[model samples]
Target: MSLLFVSASRTCRSSFSRQHILLSTSRFQSTQINPEIHQTQNQQTKADYPSSSSSNSSRRYRFYFLSIAAGALIGGAYTFRQSRKYEGLMPEYITNSEQLQRKAMEARPMPPPVTKHITFDEGPRVNFPFKLTLYQYVTCPFCCKVRAYLNYNRIPYDIVEVNSVMRSETKWSIYKKVPILVIENEEIQLNDSSMIISAIESYLRMPTKRFENISKLYQSVVEKDEKGKLSFNYPNKYFLVEPLTNERVDPTKQVQTEKTKDDARDNDATTTTKNVNNQSSPWFFTKFFSKSKSEHKEGLVNIGSGTVTDNETKSITSYNKSSEQYKLERKWREWVDTKFVHTLSPNIYCTLNQSLNTFRWFSQAGDWEQIFPWYQRWIIVYVGAVVMRGVAGRLRKKYNLNDNVRISLYECANEWVKAVGNKNFLGGSQPNLADLNVYGILTAIQGCEAFQDLMSNTKIQPWFERMKHSVEPHFADNRLRATT
Candidate 1:
């Protein structure tokens, strides 16, 4: 996910600029104090004792020497830190991108033949219709969610790396966000993680339906205020539209249900904004997905769970949301989105050193020029580290997180493990959406200190390994399939 962080370099620069004035003021004040002390000592010397002058002189000399020594020590320490090896620092954008691409190309191995399934549980091969191009930040959880969902459904797609700073790739679009998907054949531009997933899923289920018509089902409602400022709202974004009536196939109350849900959502957003930092926008992945996953708690969230008659053929595909299996699915998905995801930011950005290390990993994994440039990498690393360090503190207070963030992470993992209890996955034999979601979120921080600690501390290792084995094959398959 895109972390909402204050610009650390800008903060440091502003602070440095103010230091000059502060230093000048301090020097003038010190001069004023010294003169007063000298005048007082001289008067005392004249009245009481001749030895007072010598004692005052000795004290002044000692104070000057001590100040000099302290300054020298601080200067030496700073010089040592600055002069340390910068050879390992980030390379120029072009060079780094080329190297990374080349390495990926070299390391990628071809998948087995379509006829030859690696595992017995390999689902039926899906022949995707149109080419999909996804623009996203490499480390974004929502982007990862889309990727995981696509891979899980065996859909082939391409990726465009959008510059995190400039975001020039999406400049043409009004909804400025990562995880923008362009369906080439229909020329459809899909935004929002949940909307994208729902639209695509609807298309997949009803392949005979028009792509444009499917896109219309998830259309966002835009309104203008008295000041002419536009506000966009997506209601029942996840519900698939019926083919004939062009209405959302919702199982709940018919009229005004969407409005009620939207109102509740608006209220939640307002509350979250007022309470949480404006930085909460970057955490949209977890919030949106969690809301969708609240189906079990709120009696199903307009998912296509009930049987609907096909207008053209009169065919019906039975889907019962009230089923125990479906309920379990919703439960696990909610747990992953809400509880498990909340632990990530707090633990990964727990401390200054930890945040720095996390950025170092991002510098390696993220797009070279766009996300982490050569010159900007170090600045981002230091600045992002400090920013996240403070952000973690705020998140802890907002979420009521534990004193030790690692404990929170560990507890979350343990909960997942306990839920999986005796089974290989929540899906029993195979990995479910919940399993994939959790695995993908955790995978984002795999190289960081949090992931390592999570593996060592919790009993989630076995299930995590199983998930990796199951999900990785599909990723390799997707990559190799793209080449064809």
Candidate 2:
């Protein structure tokens, strides 16, 4: 029975299933899926989701492009700013150059041939009765020269020794250099050595006779202008004038008192009669009168007699010609400033020595011990000597200078000796400008014991002795002697 039911079900199932499928077809169509739906969904997903490498590459490209643009903008802005600043500064530099050239040309024009005369009032010539006050250092060659010149001329001057380290005290006094000369009751303040000499000459003009020989000596040492005029222009750029307590009377208004021709002839006749009367006296009185007259004439006319008037002496103080002594001193000065000074360098052992000596000479005394107490004195001296020696050696290496400097110096020394030879002064019998000029160099060299030894051992000693003897007589202060 079960087999017969299975067979019958199988045959009926096929038929019945087909009939049911057909019956359910309408319901199935309402819920049926489109064939292109899956394909369209896949296409949208492909457009939205790319491979990881491709998306990363696109993001990196965009970021790189943005960064490059930003960097270029920053660089361009900086360059523009720098160029603008440079353009603004260039014109100022060019203008400054043009201005400097203009000033230099203006300063160097040829001076006029004849300077207009400057006149001053006359009186019982105010015997510039004041002593000059000078602040100086013995070691400074310039100071030594200035002082020696003043002393040689027998100019009334007082000196105040100034330590080199204490230069600040005089910073505002003059042009910040040594040999500052001050004259009382006068507004004159002289700084440069050359200028000081000129001022001295100007003041000496009043008592010219007394300085006649000295004036001549000074005139021999300077260079002259084409017009044969010797003028000393003060190097000071400006000067200050201070008010005087009293208003002095102007003497320019004074009337001249002249003798009439007949009156002058009568006076001459009277003077002759008096002379005749004196001649007729006893032989002893006559001799005394003659001697007195001779002495008076000698006092008025003689050089080195210490009686010549200032006016006579001043006529000789021209700047165009230099004295023989001045010529010699200048040669030495040139050698030192130009040749030896250029050779100094810090590499040599002698450099330390020079540095130490300079420190001692120019620095505070106490400061040396505080800074370099361990440095021996001999060490310091050695260093200084070596430094100079090194400098000399370098100069010898660099240039083939004329060996005549030493010879010329010696010859000058010899001449100076001969001029003052056996006499006490270079002024023949009196101290004069030549002696002053030469002594400046001599005094500078004399400060060093080694230099002194060198001079003494050489042919210079004899000349030095002559100068020493010639200047001794003028050392006494006659005014003080009279008071005593």
Candidate 3:
């Protein structure tokens, strides 16, 4: 029994040893296979990841390069557009520069030319009795009338020829217009022949010389107090003399009745005076005070009797006075300038021709027939007179002159002619302001042909014949010599 049990124990030990060996072999095989699997898995993971960060960085770089290229194209286009705009707008800059350069290259210098001098021989000092310098043109007819008047009265004067086309070196040079008279060295530029003559008479204190009949009539109509206080009567007989003479067989009877009616016409006269005065403000206190105090304190004081205190009050008052005077003066000047001048122009033209012809004949040494061929001279004169008359008519229409103003001007001119009637000038029968004034208008009229025909209707023709006889001797070319 003991031997069998010992054998069994040995057999069991052998069996356990074999099982341990088998387990060891299996562990070794498992370890080798696991190493191979792990390597394969790592490779697969690497393939799936695919280097994503590197790919994104490469795409961003490509985008940046593309953006820079597009921006460069846009900037180039913009610069080209700006260049084109500047070139189109300022073309002169290019054109002018070239022109200036060409002009500068072609420039040259020049010198002034020399001229000869003329000398005048002095003549004897004939004590010229006139105080006025009669500036006249040869072609003016009014100048002839003035000359006639002066010569008729045997007045002595210094005649200054003013050729409109010829310029003078004298300090007081006359305008292009003829008949500018200088009285006592003072220029009396008369636009109207009648006004000029009238002004001369006024200056010489002979207002009633032109129209003898009118002067006498006016004097007779003048109302005088027992003490010799002078006043005027309305609807005066003198004013109606022309109408009465035209209509009546005996004008003396009408004149007497008209003179007797003076007392009854007082109311009418007063009303007319008031109406005329109302047309414009009177030259009273208001005109003197209306100005700014700072500018005209003395003027205000003269107007207001020294009542103003504040600077503001004085200024206001002075301004009012100034405005009033300006209005009055402006109105008066306008009437004289337009109305008076236009009316007398026609009548003056007629008188001028007569005077010129008279003077020419009177002064000429040769027979009147030999002095000047009438046809040649008259034709030239006639054409010039016509154009002048047309111009005058057009001017009247354009300026809207009134007939009444013209009539008054005519009356004024008639008065002047009578005042200096037979006198050589305004200054006691010598060439004076009247001569210059009349000459200017006559010059303008004589420049045309139509005006010559108009003068034939008036007493101007005979007057001109007389004047020609008086002035012909002093002239070298009698036809060309100025009447004055």
Strongest candidate by TM-score? 1
Error of 2 at 29 (Å): 65
TM-score: which is higher, 2 or 3?
A: 2
Error of 2 at 483 (Å): 31
Better of 1 and 2 by TM-score: 1
lDDT over C-alpha atoms for residue 315 of model 1 = 13
TM-score per candidate, in order?
A: 0.54, 0.38, 0.25
How does candidate 1 score on lDDT?
0.56
1-484 per-residue lDDT for model 3 (tens digits): 3223333434544466533543443354346446665455346435643557879999999999999999999987876665554343234423333222223223311110101111113221222223444555444455554554444333344445442332231223312344544333322223233334433332222112123322222221223333323232222211112221333222221111111112112222332223322121111222122111111234221111112222323222333343443343333333333443455444333344643443343323222233234653454345444554555455555655444333444454454445445644333322333333343334344433333543543333333333344433342222222221
Report lDDT (Cα) of residue 305, candidate 3.
13
Better of 1 and 3 by lDDT: 1
- Tens digit per residue, CA lDDT, model 2, 305-334: 123322332222221122333343334334
* Ten contiguous residues with the weakest lDDT in model 1: 278-287
Ranking of candidates on TM-score, top first: 1, 2, 3
Q: Residue by residue across 148-197, what tens digits does model 1's lDDT show?
A: 76766667666766656555555555456768777767666777766677
